[model samples]
Target: MNKASRSTVYDGEVTWQRIADEVGLSRQGAKHVYNKAILKLQKNEQLKQYWVDLIIEGRATKCD
Candidate 1:
């Protein structure tokens, strides 16, 4: 699934461990994917808006 979709699935409250379990990835792998997805969104202005909207709407939240 796409990063945004995956992020939505857990209501944005997913930890790396949770992502690892759900996606069958290692913790580090999940972290890498999350970071990469954020970077990609940041680099593109249009996508950045979507990312910001998601954050503002509480569609995505940082994992503790």
Candidate 2:
């Protein structure tokens, strides 16, 4: 769900509804989940690398 949400929303593409559908959720539900996750990652020093890793992996996948 994060991957789907990030790929679309991060790229300025619409259709979070589609991602929510794929994950059996509403658009707001998906956004809420993602928002919480992002906030948590930003707040945590130890887990910050995980956020960076996610971004790197995402970019890598897009490049491929």
Best by TM-score: 1
- Alpha-carbon lDDT, every model: 0.78, 0.79
Estimate the overall C-alpha local distance difference test score of candidate 2: 0.79
Taking all chains together, the TM-score of candidate 2 against the true structure is: 0.61
Return the TM-score for each candidate structure. Answer: 0.62, 0.61
Q: In model 1, which runs have C-alpha deviations exceeding 4 angstroms?
A: 1-12, 59-64
Question: For residues 1-64, what per-residue lDDT tens digits would candidate 1 score against the true structure?
Answer: 4565565644436678877877788999999999999899989999999878987776344543
lDDT of 2 by residue, 1-56 (tens): 46655565445465778767768889999899889988998899878998789889
Model 2 clashing residue pairs (backbone) = none
For residue 23, give model 2's deviation from the true position in Å.
0.9
Candidate 1 deviates by what RMSD?
Answer: 7.0
